[model samples]
Target: MGDKIVIDARGSSCPGPIVELAKAYRNSKVGDTLELWATDAGVRADVQAWAQKTKNQIDSITEQEGKIVVVIKILNR
Candidate 1:
């Protein structure tokens, strides 16, 4: 595990969180973890699907106080 890169997408709508996560992933190295904070409910499924499509590893998806926290690890890149 490496230092986590945090992306705060809170208050952002659909595609915003995923876009930020994608950007972070592109700049990250293998084994690096990304923590995305989003307020949009749809981001949960979006992130999951994006991770699968990109072959990245999702460590967890947690929700607290209407906020979503997605943990993803860079596996291929």
Candidate 2:
């Protein structure tokens, strides 16, 4: 929560948001939180699935101002 990476994916399509998140996460450290803001409805499920595949932890997901915000905690080595 304190140390995090925030990605804005508004107006992006299906895998676009997810792809951006993956790219951002690639350079992140263990235990760091990744906050993704997207307009794509698929982002919620996609991000969650991506986190599972990468062994990351999802803290919460919120919808505000027509945008979906996903908070993820990196748990990989």
Q: How many residue pairs clash in each candidate?
A: 0, 0
lDDT of 1 at 14: 57
lDDT of 2 at 11: 90
lDDT of 1 by residue, 17-76 (tens): 878888888899988899999998888889889888989999999999998999988887
Question: What are the models' TM-scores?
Answer: 0.90, 0.89
Clashing pairs in 1: none
Candidate 1 C-alpha error for residue 66, in Å: 0.9
Candidate 1 residue runs with Cα over 4 Å from true position: none
- Point to the candidate with the largest lDDT: 1
CA lDDT, every prediction?
0.87, 0.85
**What TM value does model 1 have?**
0.90
Q: List the residue pairs that clash in candidate 2.
A: none
